[model samples]
Target: MDLGIDRQALVPVVQQIISAVAQWIRNSGASPGTRLPSIRQVALDNLLSQSSVIEAFERMVAQGLLVSKHGSGFVVAQPSVLHEGQWYEGAEREWGAFVDNPMGELKLGCGWLPDAWRESDDISYAIREVTRTDTAGLFNYSTPLGLLALREQLLKRLSQIHIATHLDRILTTAGASHAQDLLIRTLLKAGDCVVVETPGYGNLYRQLAFHGVQLLQVPRTQGGPDLSALEALLQRHRPKCLFINSLYHNPTGTSLNRTVAERLLELAHRENFLIIEEDVFGDLQHASCTRLSALPHDDRVIYVASFSKTLSSALRVGFLSASTVIIAQLASLKTLTGFGTSRFAEAVVTTLLANGTYRKWVQRLRKRLRTQMAATLQVLEDEEWEVFAKPAGGMFLWARPGVGDRSRVQACARRLGVLLSPGALFSPTGEPSDWLRINVAYAADQRALALFRAMGPARSTSTILKTTSV
Candidate 1:
């Protein structure tokens, strides 16, 4: 086959063989089922060891580039086509679509921070330390309530935020989404009514819909949810639960005020509905913020938070705090659903938290996000875009062009290879709107700047002021 083997190169011999064989298959016009030279023959022809040849072939087979048949040697495999509908097929997708963007495409609407913003030294060190010190974490499943040490760390964090709770009331899950799913499975049933924000998290809307729950959406205002609208919905339908983002809301970056928090609690008590407060981005805020779970309630509030937003997403560490009764129920469901979260990941997070690495890391992250957010907001203002609210701290800014049509804005973004999170995706009904969720971390990129600048100047100063007053 004349596979090129470079002995002096830094690449290992087995990897080199794998690359050469793949290149040969592509360039030689080899069709499916075409067999290459025997492993022994290739080893002899290339002046290499048979072990290297066998390892390369096995690796190739595992990669779906080749298939091994019983006593027939390896043959080229058919090219695999990923089914479009297998996953991320609908408009409800947010993160999946962001992740699937083409290389070099600017992700201006992504949920998390850019790669350059992530500080990996502490996380990497924690991973290595866990690998060296905790053998049981590597092999065993976490307990029903998750690792005790990790939960203890979480308890300290909760205390900092003033949500006093004991270890029995805390339960760790894969992430906030997993925690939400456990709550849904344990507390809700099909045909139940749940109140959600109108322009809120798309993934949560989809999750609720998947469980056959009817969603009653209340409009989210600059202060918080429109209390009048929420109260009106409560009058007609008796919802079982109300899901809300208490701090740094997903798309708008709005934090709940103390007045709103208290009122929401009162309504929850009167209406006999549970409130699930999601605080995934709460850590990024520098000032103290009101949390629904922190307020006095009759065990009607469940708080879910995760390290995925500020920390490494791959770590998949998150926890929920609630009444001991609710925690016990959710923990049992968590065991049945996924057994438990990764003990290794929990251990790594514990190490980071115990050594104070996580606190210092988030402090730096908060400062960076604050600076980027100011710069991005300035750019938006110069380009005459209308911002929904000027966030105190966090990564998102909800804004739209002040002059151009929605279609023109989208077309310009496409031409500049900029991915945007259109307002429609945030709606529970998939209803279209002009606003877009701009992630400040990527908004400073040249491509995103160009797209925003292409919208031209605002039509009128009065119009711009009226739209952006919130």
Candidate 2:
């Protein structure tokens, strides 16, 4: 179970586990036969006693939230009285499919760095140290604004990038997604209008739909959003806000220049709509790029960031920085949602940040990614595929097939145990395109390169694949 288990609850640990799992089932839109993770996996992931996890599962079974089949592990019960609305949709399922992908596949579609790329020793050490020293994190709920220590550390990080802000303006979240969710629930009504990038994060597109918000799709340029289209959208619909990836934007791996950032902020003020700038990839950028929040004289932009991409996605630690008024509102929304982010997650990150290991890890990780990005770009150029743009520095390389039945080529690749991020998922309206998002880290794999040659470029052009170096 990828459920957030609180170990330090005043209630029994088993009860805490039960609450987490039950809430997930109710909200996740899990199907009748959906199988939960094994008791051992859940125990190991959450650092809980195996007996406690087992007890929790048994209680869930009794509560009709789960059922145990003979040797099939715990399954979601039929006729599930889940939360209203479709919480789990196609976009989420797409991301989950990649997560649950079999190791045998060439996972060029994944969002995070591969498991082999992570500093397991450093991460494990942080987890162990936090578990040993921070007894309160294990049992207690996090503060509404999250751990002060973590926020303090984040303040320093923002300073390094010229994003000046105080701790009070920050609110920690489960991840960047959670921070976005909190803002959506807090600021938007069921039928409110909001603007999203045309080729944007699909997960956010689905999430906005879940909230029943009307999304105005703004096309993106290499530098930033198409400003003329954005102005027209604002004039026509007057959306409540505009959600965007500012620095090192996802899929395309492009950052907003200072001129564009200033223009966006001007539009936000004149048009009277908020700007939710998602800087999740900020730390990953090789250069110090200008973020929208850099012009913070007015509180129109809310800065969202995550450690998941740079550190460990499993930790689910992220935060948002905004004016005190906005932070207070979003923090309350967070309280009404999941109480706050995991205390354990906050403590683990705080420890790493305080000791300066977090900085060192990201620095090394960025260097490695820069190397991979260059090699991946070279391979794509050699194959004559059209790249969206050469990334300054980031994980993804959005590219077109240049030739062939894109759908057929994708299907063929998948049959051979290779996964590609289809372009349709990145569009707000699920519009089809020839673009594919490639993960730079995984591009180094010789097997993946061979598969790409044979199943991708080769199939597209009806030519034999060369077995030379990628």
Candidate 3:
């Protein structure tokens, strides 16, 4: 409010006030506890409505430029910034670096929603409520099975998909990856043979190898895993477990059908090997509710799901649904390893789900994902790239090269500041491939569309990624 008004300018009053306050904070070299003017005073001083000042200050609070106290009013806070760090070696570190700040690079391979797409008001409200009166959330450690209310809410989600599960059989973890880690620790030993989908979740390759488990690759089709190839693997290696994605499969965006699910369970019963279903993208699927966890009893299949994809990844709220025995073992391991998941995070997600905000957000997310998918596919098709399947709803679209060399196309993309995930990363053997997995959410950017279209005959084949490995 220190600055005079510029009504003749095109800027909105709210934005102008925001700009004035931001400039004042920096020019004054405001310390952390420095007080901001009251909303009413700012409104009166600027000759604007209280709502205008409220909106401006609310935005500042969300951006961490200001903090609001109950009765005293708003105070100065540090400015928010994006994550910054040096690149490190490892699949996890590689992805971390890619997302930190891609500059102008098109994130066609990233699997997350852009930061601008999230709904902050509801999250902010939930956080405030938790801090206000959330005793169980703030003071006590979460039960090994996690907050009952959250687990019960998740049980309702499971029921929606026809997968009947009880709270006693559910154990919460840090995320889906943590769930998988617990399963690996409890069920299998070193040198154990594990059936992994070829061209599947890329990071799992390193994780399994790190645990000293031998991987048996099974090629996945549009319906599911190639049953013929799978049965042969079971016959050859007698593996202990199979990790599969049934709905909106990662890197491929393919789903499994009832026939495939039934056939898979039948074969599992015949072969006596367990299946770990990674349905992390289940909530975002367009259709098809057939799950290995839904079929028969829960003896042979373990289901892992998370809120990371649809909700905030920083929260890390995920759970495992399986038989009572498996759940007990997982809960014990979770207790031994980390004691418990964050009670506050679980409570926040629980509130979102129970209040119906989370479902509405997921529905909106699905719609956005579908739109992005259609647009990405159209661009790829226009370029004569061969898509593996038409995904109904999901983040990924796998395709093979049609008009350009895979290596050269990727190299050219890098030069244009476009990061692309080549097919070789998805495969267990790391063999060269003509395929690429384009994340629909990331591809929605115009830069990505232009990048895909730019890979025509005009662009040169030689570039930096020609010999460099991902």
Candidate 4:
């Protein structure tokens, strides 16, 4: 029970207690089901408050290190055998674009922001406020449409982007993935043709394939999907839907220009196909950035967005806006599959939005990401890397060395303790590629720079391709 709590250390008392207990259990070879000292006894032995002991115990239980027995107190739980490498075993790794990087490795290709960059104050306040004020949020399931307050806030947000929608057309989801799943289930049948970008979101490709849909990949140009190729596909195949990332497209970091957006809508209307616009990174762009859903023909576009990229990923709150009919269908499917999204998480997001904390935080995030993007681009230029496109604003920067084997580049990344997202994983068919999806947030790290530096400079002018622009 002697945890040797360092009261003067910078780490919190609760965290220290949790670490000490975990280490003790590991070193002493505590078996599963072994009961631990009571909270009162631990507090007394360590000269700490019972609240601190209880919090530490609760955190450990949440981490699966301990199990809280109703009357018997906390006991050790079975140790996990899954290591970080196992998370990316085979196909899982290719589709797991948002998975956390292994400990001590630079997540140069990861989706979310680094832990240090996240603002904890507003989020922490929201969590505390929700827990204190909303009792039902903590215990009950959300309504079919979602928490009313959160939906209202989302509606306001949509209006700012010029996307007009009512509360009945908004449906909360676990995340953008969940929204996509519901849409796929509600609108698509097996063997239906769906148009996806060649270098698109890998997870979406996997999901559509799993649903037994026929994938028709259209080449993605800097401005957006190649209109000529897309038009050709529409003529050749009667696709049921076209999935697209309108703003800050994943991997490529490109946005759809107004001209392309108009053309896409026209095609959707002509081809009799739905357009599922994934705007998860829309908030990170300037307010004036073009969106398909913001256009007058929005009925054909089902808009899906989430706060996971800018806000905390742990807070899996997302929403989709569509025609009332589509929303009703999705809501029913959501209720049947998962009951509903998290009411508590929705409440927390609502609190942040209502108090204007989320708006200010996103503004700050956009500024920081812009700065990082510039720095990372400068470094890539200095290293003579071929950038796919210089995004106006977003977390991703797709680039590759002017000359090198893709396998060698990956091996170099591993040697430098950096994790990278290979471009092949972004392809619909999983074709071999030399391109890489670099996260601007992590590309500035010295470890990431080391990997770039190792690749050396572009060999010749002929080797470098023309940089695409929006």
Per-candidate TM equals: 0.79, 0.79, 0.77, 0.78
- Model 2 compared with the native: what TM-score? 0.79
Candidate achieving higher TM-score, 1 or 3? 1
lDDT of 1 by residue, 77-146 (tens): 7633111121222353336447764335678888998888888888899999999999999999999999
Choose 1 or 2, whichever is better by lDDT.
1
lDDT of 3 by residue, 248-347 (tens): 8988999888888998888888888899999889999766667899889448999999999889898999999988998988889999999899999999
Please give, for residues 1-66, the per-residue lDDT of candidate 2 as tens digits.
565543332234565576567557765778889999999999898888889888879976765668
Per-residue lDDT of candidate 4, residues 1-470 (tens digit): 98766554333577567657865776687878999999999999989999999988997786667899999999998744111122113236333323632235677887788999998989999999999999899999999999999999998999888899999999999999999999999999899999999788888987898899999999989999999999888778999999999888998999899999999999989889999999999889864688899888849999999989889879999999999999999999999998999999999999999999999999998999999999999988998889999999989988998666764575455445567788767877767678899999988787788778767564333332111000
RMSD value for candidate 2? 11.6
In model 3, the runs with Cα more than 4 Å from the true position are 1-93, 102-104, 457-470
lDDT of each: 0.83, 0.79, 0.78, 0.83
Off by over 4 Å in 1: 1-88, 92-94, 458-470
- Per-structure clash totals for the candidates: 0, 3, 0, 0
Q: Model 1, 84: alpha-carbon shift in Å?
A: 16
Q: Which run of 10 residues does model 1 get worst, by summed lDDT?
A: 80-89
* Cα-based lDDT at residue 6, candidate 3: 53
Candidate 4 weakest ten by summed lDDT: 461-470
